[model samples]
Target chain A: MSQPGPDAPSQPLRITVLTDGDTRPPGLERIEAEADVVLAHDEASLRKALPGSQVLLVTDFRTAALEAAWDAADSLAWIHAASAGVDQLMFDALVESDIPVTNAQGIFDRNIAEYVLGMILAFAKDTKQNVRYQQDRRWVHRDTETIEHKQALVVGAGSIGRRIGTLCRAVGMDVVGVARREKPGDETFSAIHAQSDLDTLLPAADYVIIAAPLTDDTQGLFDAGRFKAMSPHARLINIGRGPIVVTDDLVAALDAGEIAGAALDVFETEPLPADHALWGYDNVLISAHMAGDFVGWRDALIEQFAANLARWQRGETLFNPVSKRFGYAPSSQ
Target chain B: MSQPGPDAPSQPLRITVLTDGDTRPPGLERIEAEADVVLAHDEASLRKALPGSQVLLVTDFRTAALEAAWDAADSLAWIHAASAGVDQLMFDALVESDIPVTNAQGIFDRNIAEYVLGMILAFAKDTKQNVRYQQDRRWVHRDTETIEHKQALVVGAGSIGRRIGTLCRAVGMDVVGVARREKPGDETFSAIHAQSDLDTLLPAADYVIIAAPLTDDTQGLFDAGRFKAMSPHARLINIGRGPIVVTDDLVAALDAGEIAGAALDVFETEPLPADHALWGYDNVLISAHMAGDFVGWRDALIEQFAANLARWQRGETLFNPVSKRFGYAPSSQ
Candidate 1:
């Protein structure tokens, strides 16, 4: 990494956040303090701030600014998103430019792992129904099965998946991990199943969790055929992207009793349309994609951006850089 | 604590398990191996078996059997119900009998404690809506709060309540235990609050969990006045007997936004009528009285009974005896 020569002109660092909610992240203050300008979504404001900046801190690339700047970018040199899934922002921004795009990959790993554990506990223990019954003023006592020693299959060996495997191990569950590249280092997993082993793993798992990224190889992965491979008592939980599971296939799986129940938080569309049939099912538990949402999450994202900022300034290889192999290297790392 | 005298006469033991659900706990072979006769809610069979048997195992006391046996002059003296709650059973069968009674008190403490933690996580993390949105094809996103350092008021320092407090402590929560009686030798509690101190403790708690038995003082405990005392951001969870909390007060609390929400798992009634007003409230999480329904529970109970049986066969006082202070005794100790 070469520094600016004595005669070279210094440039104002440009910062773009992938998605900006109502409150700006505190990381923005750190960026502003160290640099000259801050550019982010809230479109009009980004447009005004864009010309004077040189670095962009984005959590996603779907911003209209990124779309508009795809072919016209001149001053923007470095772009980073504050999330694991950079596919939405990185593909269009990165394939076209030599500028490096870093993502906040490791931030959500443990958090999302906790989310998966929460959903699994809810489903296996029949937790939500207990809440529903008390509302009816009924005291119906019944036996429910716990998760101890149950067979579980994790579809991804990424950071979140590995963390979930560790937590599952703590609860005395038998776990297997699946991935594109076989890794022998995962001692927490009973065995690392390859992508081709998914079919073999499906029938044996009492619970199947989707934690993999959505790639061409992974997209539309759990369709009708895969759903049929599951046992009627088996349950499916998707913490990854929505398209990774074909919605109709899941509905059919539930309908045919190929699976006992589903706890889904990610879907193809959100604020879901009023007339969705999956809403009518008894065995399904739908949550707004809030598993990884905790109050202090803003601080986590801020820390990620702060670290990436240091890396960008030093011109060093950043943590969670988009993998060169995947065209869109997004992660819930 | 003396063993049976050499001159003592031995006779067949009669076991009557008066439970709601139509099932048997595992390892019934042990009971059959020792008991000369078994009675399971069959009035004629129980009548026949009761006259000669010396011991009775009352399975949670079905009311009809209690009514029929009150007048019977049976040799049976001791009765044991496989439950922690003994209010209704005590009222019906043990008020005048010289027979001793015991209960399955400590068996469910850990499991129910785990259930309380499950509810807390569900309430704070929004597992309810997570299940709802997945079916609607929505990837809903929102910030959620955690219980890391929040204050929890556990309004029962009995076995189940203490276990809940322990689990909460493990999660880094500030725990306060409240009960009718606070013994000096009871070091399990970090801080003790009397029943009268509930109001003083309510405002500081992010969660108010009711795990108290239904006593004269505890019945209708969380009436409107108590709900009003809680913080607006607080959540109320009841895993104790239903009458302990006045249902109408809960509704009013939720309606007025006096508290964030509630998770209830028990009620005064069974099979709550479909039209109950409590069912209409969206903020309430209702579960049938099923906090003790985890898998392997039957086996665990059977093992407990077998150990207790060995003690009972000898002339030792039972481990979970009903309070003799009240002057009434169960016939199946």
Candidate 2:
């Protein structure tokens, strides 16, 4: 693999975008005015477009066509994903290549943080049961718990988790963050503990929010044992990668009443099957994998990509560079 | 009515409580130890207990038995309501009498503030629809709006409305409060507008929260003309008295899609009848009037009363004294 020189290219750069059908990024006109744009949705289209493109914009991170067409990516110098996690693109072929990869990280932090706060307040106020009563036209007056002064244990200490901690603290909650390493606390968290302290923290937490990335150390981290360690009244919220939680163990925990409730936005499988037992639990709140999505997100992603493109043209380092081995953008970036 | 001297009472003070059956305030034993306590549920019981009683505590605000038996209240010197609004106790007899009225004001401020935040976040996140889709086990992903930097118009300047504004500001919202008189802006609100400015404010607000008391000027304030002046995408939340909004006009506005959605915790009628049309609207969220109720709210109310009882024994003015002519506790009290 040869690196591009700092000198400007003699011709316009060719940028190819891989997206699902009908998933065009907004504000592409800003990028199109300065580059040759090619939109590809399938393996055949991607392979044909990959041969001449110098930059690849993976708008649909779920597609595996990138791995299949890597052999034809002769002119590809940089890859940018329109998602926070680059796990799908970290296959053996790309990992061995020299092309630098960047991701859209900071854009989703506040949006996901707001979503988690909504779930916490919803659980504390019994909003799900309220809606159910509304549907049945039942006037049921019940007491609800308060989140003020309540403890929250965030399992991840990344940007997203920090934002969640900040929002929770703003509402008078006591926040503790768990990361792979113990560190000095910031304004958002009172203390950051090592993962080994999860068992100790679980009992004190009224809410356990998962915002950790999917890595070898985190897969299946929340099993029956961990659930059993938590307080019976504590709730679990997963806004991170789905594989970090064992779905079956969570169902068992709910069935046995080991925990009060859960709100799951992601699953081990995409579009969790219609027969999934998790959906049948009255205490569980489910949402499609959209915790970080907001209206006009596509336009925001395009703007971020365009800014990075300008830096690339000047041979400056990209903004949110991801380490292939780590599977996520480092917090420092 | 003879004015009591500033000296301690020579005899035990007679304290009568008006509450629904099986609804005694929590921690009443502490008060019972010092005073002669009488509990009354209906008009006959209230009349039997009112004679020679110096103080009345109205825990059930819906009761009109007090008005029916006002003639028997020969020795009643003061009345304390376990609610923020004193409309139920604001009969002509009490308003024109020498007896002073007080209410539970500060107790419900934080609780109601949290509830309003829950509703705002729920609407912005589309949480009610999320639960519906969850029940059907359908994973349909959709974009949701964000509440950050959104404009909120709170139509009250009381403790509860102020707290709501503070919490909304904590989550990055721009808050504008409406009161009868304009005041210097506090940290919670950017500006406090007079009632006359609502028409101009309504057009720009993304969320309009009603927390005003049930007063002559506020009754039927949110009618068809006001609703028409609001943006089509704005949402309305009512945690205040029900009569402040015309129920029929609200229904018509919602049916016509003039507003995006609403979350109504108060209604023109309590225990909103099962056949009510408001229950059928998919865009509206309905809850029983328990927004300010937390797990131990009864105990908190009793504690507040006990503190005020000490001041009464000393023949001093009570806390939270209401303006009988105004039908609510004035902010200064």
Candidate 3:
């Protein structure tokens, strides 16, 4: 509702790009040609460049520079994130501000869904064991479980979660989705339940996938009680935000055999310290949080931002507008 | 055509079982009640037991004792293999005889298809690299390939291959099937080609899956030339017989970077010796011949044979009859 009306500003638009200086987003020349653009690589630079800027284009999702420079933003109208999850950008001031926020959401759904399915199949076929045995030059013939007719419970019935459910069902899995609000089942999900029903749903799931956004209600969602509710034969896959799961409790669950295993792409502490206990487990699959990053993904993210920027210049409603109260775009499902 | 007429035999059926003495097939009490059963553990036992038996049920797929005891099968009316591939039972004398052979075909189609899909997804996602990184406790972020709209070429458009095609298509891949005879494409495949079209189809496929049976025509089907024809980005998956691809040529292909990688479940040599070079490649995934061997698969195989036995008792046509001339069942595709 805070989106600007259809009246173009008389002055030239000013945009500030906060980057980490690793790689600059490509295909931004056209945007730079018409606007006064400033690339801020650090908090001091961001603070220096924030004054007189109407748009903040955040390329570094890991930096807290924007919040540190918030007092300098005297004329900011909007904030645009280059990533799907806008958790890093949702500081207290921004959440309480009148500035509207948008994100790169639809670009990542398919690739992330594919990544989740790959992890599910990897566990079912025991690919990691195959690698370990091959390394030892051992030919151990083991019987693996079949994914067919197995149950998959995906938490988060948003675009990414629905795509995960669709792919799981494609491979003959009985898929059920858990959303914040209940909806009628479609081709992808056999049923959709409210978040409160997760406890009852966990016991029958062969694979429990977390694709929910990071929100106040979802933080620490997969704690001790949730893990204990899961079937011991189930695997936990978190492609969602890291803090949604308590790391120590997950370690304990793995130690006690409360769950079969976990394929974690995100963590509370990233580049997870060398001596982290999760690294020592044979069943854990640790990825470097690159689930949605396919080849040429940087360009795709930039393209999405550029399109949304065009809409902003003309004072039109934006795509993927985040609901500040909920910390994510509420589902139309 | 060799099946007996629908007239109940006055004498009780004499059945011989060829086993390697490891484990006996379960759930045969009902069959044993109506038949004179003899369990043969070796070549000498098989020869001694074959003189009066009208049916031979083979449980040991790797044994050559059947060929050694062929001369003693004077009263042989039918042969049933407890495995999908009847390659070991297809000796010259058996192939040249009027006696019919049947296999456990339909029992393995879905599981094998699932295995093939898992391998395809593994290579696309770089799961082996994740395992290696986890072993070193390193966090290496890398972009992976998306399987959506990728092309998959399936060699051998029989029940197993068709199932693989169907599953690949379910995940949004463009699938093509290869068979002995060309047929119009169905819901599973975008097109169907004859065996001769493999050369043209090889270059375009992102994944080439071998699901053909081991036979005179298919033996050494993938040699140096076939490997050269495949795209450098393509990964080869073999869930079919081992000799379908030449191991030495595969090694050379890897050395020359002819193909991206291979996920081999079968090899020309069983237990793929510890000294074999295939075990050393980071890109190659070596799995013991267990692609279709899900939990309870042994019982499933026996169950298929039992159903066939019931039909044999009623003098009706058998399921999965081998062509003998082609060394496999002529596919209905």
Candidate 4:
């Protein structure tokens, strides 16, 4: 795994994408046909074919065989992961290498933010319960509420958070952004409050949305103290990393009526345990961290990588390059 | 229904709220505590209650009780409906009379728009399915589509539609607004198109959101012809009245794969009939018309009404008074 790609190919540099049983996107097959394209399910064959490959696109994450294949790849120059929140891709060994890594970031920001808002509205409007009742054919007429003219304290003002805040603000909700560090004169928001303002914002906000990237500062940010500060009628929606919110603390908060309701997309554990209290709770909406799922997902990621490839070929910077300041260096995690 | 109140000892105006329930906002109790407030449930009760009542706050359209209430009320000086759509409240009886009618408009406009965006996101990214799958303890991971850079077409470029357009634009979507009559030099929209231009926009849009009122022009606007013109991948979300999109046409569209998905909050039939095929489709997300549901709803509505009430007392016009184009007075419907 110590060599670079062939100095130059007769055609464009060949790119091999090992995805989860999904075909190459519409235009990608044509691109691959022009280059030395190889599709593989297992890592051994992909690695065997990797010496000629300049780009390796991964759709799935963290398989032992894939790791083994990566270990043997002699000419794998760079890896393009087709997922947001590439924490799973950043193992010790991979980060210890100088290989530049890129992810589909802005691609999923608005989509995921919309997903969070969807769950909030769905739960608040008793959409599922109403559907169940409608299935039973009940004319159970009830007055509904709305998310207008209410305060929304959005934690983690990243790309997704900015989009979420803008959308929420357009809908008449007062948007307050909270980040690790405050930016200067950022008044597009009512105020760009830092993490310290959580106490003041928590109690006042009708909705608290978590959309920050997972970091040391963000881990366990939504715990008992934060939840308690929220009004009993307030709601919490987290699309960020699961550990950013302490699940046990959230459960206690919900149990004690510290907050009105909560929705979880990402969990501290994947495929949350069968006995997890979150599944049975009436107010809580639980999703399997699949807020980023869609019909043309692979195609979208491929399109992004394809664009980045053009940028790379033209000696231009990538579209969504994660900055080194976020504790992500090429050779260090 | 008619009685002299001890508290409102001035020229007492008996106010009857012709609602299913809970038209009471925060400051509503003060009016109830002062004036003779009556809850009219059935047509007979409403008829009996309206004789001496001055104001009727109607919240439901379940029965012909409103007609009866209007018929029996000799001194019916004013009426207010708790919903934005005042069609059910304004008819031959209330329209012909000199009664002043008002509605809760501009209140839920943006919030409802946000809900439409949320529903769009939900369908585009499969949020609810993920939630259900998570509950079943599935770790199934899949690629999701992105909403960024999509083209959205908003129908009925009023307050709600405009808000929905802006919200969509904020998420990097190119949004076009459609209305009955295009307002000249409307800076709120990127491209203001006539309602007739829907056919051209329908095929280009990834999302078609209906936030228009249930007017004669808009009723059954999204019928079969319109549905057929839409791309099979595009989603249709109706925060407008259900009748706007023929429910049967929508069902046919969904079953025949004319469109990708739909999130119908309002229905042609409220508490959408038990055996409706709309509920049976996996792709269709039935929201029981609760896109406007959120916490702090009552307080928000009340505050708006309070401000309007003060304006009314000061002999000033209200903020969201319905247009008197149909030879009907502005009755609070």
Candidate 5:
């Protein structure tokens, strides 16, 4: 285990990055200036690189190769996930290990919030129908619903959820937040309820946004029963982990017209197979797990990782340290 | 001429409503209880009904029947337009007449603002692409732009433009307003500029929103030259009048990719003739002129007109009185 006190390391730290080779963080040369850097793509490369590496940077958060190579990581002291959700990287070996895990948290909050707001507005304004009418060269004048004074129940009380609530409030929405723990109401949320209240809150929501992490408690949280509880006119937007929503149950709910529509950025199986029935639903909007990704995000992630690297070099506590037990970085607030 | 003083009329006023036979204000029975109500859908009916009517309510503001039958309007004292823009009704005979024209201005302001925000968010988050990908059943991950900290220039300092600016500001955008006359800065706009500044402001805007009235000064304002002045990445949104943008020039600019895209609600022609080339553009989002028409808008319009009618009956000053010379209701502010 690495010591916690402020003592400079005697030698250069070994940093191994796991990515699909399409995008490694830009400005990585800044980190390479001090450390010995290695890029690995698959299980074989990761296994070969994991031994004797002091720090592992999971740029490709989707890969579970790290878990398979955990026994080979003899000198790994820390892991940094270049993503807000670190569920894929949270294997039993990692949770049981003494290594500290950090995630890119604050970086994606406002971007994801904007994405959620966009989806809400898209549903309210019926933009999908507008596109359809345009495609057919048919000019149909239709009345649209206003989102103002409408109820939005955000299913997470983390930074991203709070930011989503704040943006929604700016547009005159009545925002309610549901979290694992009860929290006092703030400018963003009119009220914050415990997870136990989700069943009660779901029916009242015109928009339900999921920004919660995928923990054991949250896995399959939004199943058939919860979908059945939501208003028929309500929309579901999930930017969180995909498994949190039972895909088969969601399809059934959507098929039954239990809800108006949904915008799913993440999926249970990403690169969501081409033959998936979810794609066939006109009411269901599908995007490739990129709600939080903005142009230049790679540069920003590199900057964040460099800052954390500097802290690690100084033996100081890292920012956005994730709680292995909770499966997310606990909110600093 | 109707006298302007605080004295109730001895006789009930005769009201004629011009509509397209599709929608009439809901709960209009309340108004019918006090006045002699006549509904007319065409020039023949309008001309026959106009002679003895004390008030003419233009529910279908797109009609020019009022102007054509103006000589037959012997007892028409007040004209109420159930629309913000009175351009169509601002014919020579009506504008030169002493009859006071009142419009449903406040009713559309916030709703149109919401529509503009929805468009801005749609452009930023690329919701259009999301739909296309969903249709194709392809899950391709890509980075999206953020609306926060982006610059939006709204061309019109009226209530609608101010409302749009306020909503944009609430979502962390920097808003600039342009109008015919200069005004002091407000919470919504950082600064208000003269229409002359539009040339200078166009380049700096990431989003250019047209909310100005259709007048001699504004008609064809966004020609090919003006489109060229905008950034390649900037998007144009017109919720105002379609003639304000030269349709052919807009098509040329769009084809040339001079601007990123556009969301055009009101077009130069109604129902935008099916074979028009504008409908073929993937980048353009076309919606029928229904931005301000929310679910209960007709009811709201009736309520506004009813209040104005009560004032007219009491011989009191009316709300939303248009400036004949300017072609829109003069803002009381």
Candidate 6:
């Protein structure tokens, strides 16, 4: 971190961008102007570019090829994810290495919170039935439930989960949180319980929200036993990774009327097959994994990364650095 | 207003309920035990019951028979409407009469506010389209709009409108209200503009909610000229009376793409005929006129009246008294 002498100029920062396709990120001109920009579509290209790169910008955030190309990162100092969740980037080697990781943490918090609120309101108002009735040209009047004093249990206490809790509380819902450990809740949650208390908390929650990152401990967290612990009138909302819930168990739970309804924006499989049983249920609301993808979000994502990149170049501490062992940024950070 | 001496027993309070059908309001046992309860199914029955009644409760909230039976209300001291809006009861005779009218005001405020918020969110998230996509078994990924920082214009500054503004502000929307006069806004609206300033406000509003009651001044308020003044991307949500929005003008506006969409719970015609053209639009969301009728709402309405009746018997100031000329309870009241 030594400053260069008056006669000498530092070398340009070399950055390898691991992309899903050949196309580069939009509005990445600022980054490209001052750095050596290497776009890699796959593991072979990423490996070839990694030797001279001082930083890795993961634009293809979900690719598994980063682990394969890890051995060639001879000059890599920091790794940045263009997404909030760095689940795919937390490999055994990366977690065990001295390299620090940062993610686009705060970017998706409010957007995802809004999406969750919309889902919650949609369920409470029976909006899906209203749409169906409109299509049938039939006038059906049904009394709706209110969320004013209802309880919401947010499964994750990350930035996204906290944002969800804040908005829920703003609309008069009593929100509680589940995290790695128990703590007194802040302005968002009434109380935050340890993950171990989830079974006891599940029964009281009128709405259970999954906003955790995909991790070894979180994957398959809401299985048959967890669903059984929830109230029959409770609704399950998953904006987190799909693998976090056992799909078969959820299907069984829905079929048996063990749970009232679910609004899932993610599934274990991407682009759920047309024959999927979940698609046929009237009580289940299904959407592609797009809870946080608001219009102009790409530009916002690039802007967030640009800020972080500038901070890295200046040797200032990066924001949203991940706690590698936990696989997501801890609340304290 | 003088209290009777201990030796004088007070006569029972006679109440006439103008109903559209023979069935009386549920849980009337509490009221029937203390008073002379008359269930009138038509104008004739209401006329006969009204001669000796001191209290009149309108359960068929939209009936026009109140005006026809007005002459027989010789002993009437106060009128109570089970529904929130007192538009139907604000007849020429009633407006000039010394009798006071009370409505079920606060009972529907939060419920209607939730409904309006639900409609706003449904439009912002393209929830109707999402439901359609799910029905088709298609995994469509489209960027959605966010309500945060968006502008909302709520016409009517009564309890329901204020509640709507409060909820919209809770979700980070910039809310402005349209009322009878210009005033600095409170906790709900950023500003409350007089009705004369609506044209200037319309162009900036992302969502226009008609929460005003049906009065002479408000009837046919949203006409062709007003629609033309609105942003093309704006949505109209009417949880108030239907006649406030001219049906033909609204249809034309939607057809011409002058407005993006509408969520109409109240139509000029109830149970909006199956053959109505509004039923076929992909952008129009139609529901039976039950926005504020959450489960147990009837009980809530009855409970509200029971409390007000107790106050009336004790010669205390009645709650939710209407300004007959204005049709609904003014904010000052």
For this target, which candidate reaches the highest lDDT against the unseen true structure? 2
Show where candidate 2 strays beyond 4 Å.
A5-8, B1-8
Poorest lDDT segment (10 consecutive residues) of candidate 1 chain B:
B1-10
Give one digit per residue, the lDDT tens place, for model 5 in A140-210.
Answer: 98899999899989988887888888899988999999988888998888899999888988999999999
Instruction: Kindly list the per-residue Cα lDDT of model 3 for residues A127-244, writing each as its tens digit.
Output: 8999999999999998888999999999999878988998999889999999888889999999999999899999999999999988887899999999999999999999998999
lDDT-based ranking: 2, 5, 3, 6, 4, 1
lDDT for A150 in candidate 4 is 74
Docking class of 2: high
Chain A in model 6: its TM-score? 0.95
lDDT of each: 0.70, 0.89, 0.88, 0.70, 0.88, 0.88
In order of appearance, the predictions have TM-scores of 0.80, 0.97, 0.97, 0.76, 0.97, 0.95
Error of 5 at B269 (Å): 0.6
- What does the lDDT read for residue B295 in candidate 2? 92
Q: What is the TM-score, restricted to chain A, for candidate 4?
A: 0.82
Pick out the ten consecutive residues of candidate 4 chain B with the lowest summed lDDT. Answer: B324-333
**Which lDDT value does model 1 have at B192?**
78
lDDT of 4 by residue, A301-323 (tens): 77888787767666565566544
Model 3, stretches more than 4 Å misplaced? Answer: A1-10, A331-333, B1-8
TM-score-sorted candidate list, best first:
5, 2, 3, 6, 1, 4
How many angstroms is the interface RMSD of candidate 5? 0.8
Better of 3 and 4 by lDDT: 3
Shift of residue B288 alpha carbon in model 3, Å: 0.4
Error of 6 at B128 (Å): 1.1
